[model samples]
Target: MKFLVLGATGATGGLFVEQATAAGHEVVVFVRNPAKLTPRDRLAVVAGDVRDARALAEAMHGTDAVVSTLGLGKAKDPANLIADSTRALVEAAEEGGTKRLVIMSAFGVGESLPKGSAILRFLYKGGRATFADKAAGEQILTASPLDWTLVYPVLLTGKPSTENVRAIDLAELDRLPGLPRISRADVAAFLLATAVEGSWSRRTAVLTTGR
Candidate 1:
């Protein structure tokens, strides 16, 4: 399968690019700085910003699917940042006729916000702008015609993948049974699998580490 990864230079997105390349999938990564991404077999780089829909659409040729790991990146008003990027992505995907989309979202963005622990709720509330932005992105995906899966992961970690990941419903978010931190590698694994396999289609899945 072929993939176009947004924000492919970030930690989680970089892991997706590496793992997808290792798995023998063709990859085209859209980034602002192509120099940040090292050349690899089966990997192609497209230089562009996430907010550039025309560029994203142009890069979407021959793309079997898309994986977005976009984040705020030190923006003072993060809501607009995510919302604009998400809108551009949705438009580009539609224009390019790319249907499959797997996006990484925060756990506290939408329905899961009220179900979080005290600290989690407090943090999300404190950072409501960012969470609201993510919620807006989710709304866009929800309304789009594309096959989409929104994976909402709790606090992310930098550990290597154990592949012990599970996606629970948002209704079960507050009652999670194990550690809340999920490794970026595990998240990448789940995203790649979902994009290729089409499981959990058109749903909001909360991703977390499980034994």
Candidate 2:
């Protein structure tokens, strides 16, 4: 499978690229600065802004699946960047005939907040802007006909892959216990599995290190 990863420059995104390539899948990373990623086998870099639909469409040509790990890291400003990039991906995917799409979202975005655990709701209280931005982006993807899987991972950590990650749907949250978090490596593994196995089609799942 050929994957076009949108946030290859980020922590989780970089992990995904490495994992995907290690698994023998071809990977393409769209980034503003290609030099940030050292060239690796089975990896191709496409340089461009995420909001450019025409450029994204060109990159999406022959892409088997598109994965977005894009996020604003500590730039407290409220820019609807997620929404803007999502719009471009949706348009580019439509134009390029790419069907499978996987997106990284947080636990409190959209209905995840209301349907989430108490701890999740409280933790995201001060992240109104960020959550809203992610929700807006998710709204666009949800409305599309593509095979999309929205992954809502609770607070991410830098730990190595637990290899015990659980992908739980919203209704099954009650089955999970305590304050949940997942390692970026685990998230990357799940994202790659979800795309490759064609699982969780058109559904939103909450990812966590089940206790």
Candidate 3:
């Protein structure tokens, strides 16, 4: 499969690119900085901004699927960059005639999870503005004609994958008492698998480690 990644330079996005290429898929990275990506035969880098629909469409052309791991830094303003970028991506994908889209969003952005501790809820409340942006992004995808799967991952860690990840429904997720953290590598792996195998299509799944 031919794939286009929107946040190729990001930590999770980079892993997705590597895994996709390793899986023998043609990977095209739409990124602002091309130097950050390692040289790979199956990887192609395209320079562009997520806000520019034309550029995104150009990069998305001839692609079978798109994976967006776009995010805003903590230091950034509350302009909701991810939501804006997702709107642009949806428009670009629509124009480019690409149907499959897999986007990553943090858990507890829109729906309340059950296992969140006081600290987690407090932190999430503090960053409510950012999560609102993510919610808007998810709304855009859900409303679009494209076949989209939104994966809400819990707190991300740098540890390697344990292959013990499980997908929880919204109600089950909300019933939990504490948030579960998953490795970024595992998130990437799941995104790649979903893109190729079409698992969890048109559904929003909360992903986390069993432990």
Candidate 4:
């Protein structure tokens, strides 16, 4: 599979690139800073911003699937770059005839999952602006004609892959008290698996440790 990964320099995106390449797939990373990526035989690094549709189209040309792990460090800011960038990516993919897109979103964006205790929610809600932005991006992808899967994970941690993750639907999610966190590597694995197997196409799933 030829894969186009946006946010390749990001923690989750970088893990996706490494895992995808190791799986013997051709991976192209759309990045603004090429120096951040180490050169590898199976990985092609394309230096460009996600807002550039033409450049994205060029990078996405002949790609089998696209994955976005784009993250904004400051969630309190009013700007929503992910939403903007993903809209551009949708256009580029549509024009380029790519059908599959897998994007990362936080767990509580569109669902009523009680992802945190009262205190945690109160603390996290400071970034409501950012969550709303991600929610908008998700809406765009959901409405598009492409086969898309939105993988919403719980709070991310830097642990190793346990490979014990499970996908829960909205109903199951609401009953849980903030889904168990999984490693970035496992998240990457799930995304790549979804792309290859088309396991969760046209659906939004929350991923977490099955604990």
Highest-scoring model, TM-score: 2
Question: Which residue segments of model 4 deviate by more than 4 Å?
Answer: 113-120
lDDT of 4 by residue, 119-190 (tens): 546655766788888888888888899999989887789899999998876555545453357788889999
Scored by lDDT, the top model is 2
CA lDDT of each prediction against the hidden true structure: 0.86, 0.89, 0.85, 0.84
User: Per-residue lDDT of 84-189 in model 2, one digit per residue for the tens?
Assistant: 9999999999999999999998887877677766776777788999988888888999899989999988889999888998788875565344577889999999
Candidate number with the higher TM-score (3 or 4): 3
Q: Candidate 2: which stretches are off by over 4 Å?
A: 171-177
Sorting all predicted structures by lDDT, with the top scorer first, yields 2, 1, 3, 4
Model 3 steric clash pairs: 114-174, 114-176, 115-176, 115-177, 115-178
Residue-level lDDT tens digits of model 1 in 71-113: 8766758847778888999999999999899999888887887
Better of 3 and 4 by lDDT: 3
Predicted structure 1: lDDT: 0.86
The per-residue C-alpha lDDT of model 1 at residue 36 equals 95
Looking at model 4, report the run of 10 residues with the lowest lDDT sum.
170-179
TM-score, cand. 3 = 0.94
**Candidate 3, 77-151: lDDT as tens digits:** 659688889899999999999999999888777775335777677667767788888888888889998999989
Select the stronger candidate by TM-score from 2 and 3.
2
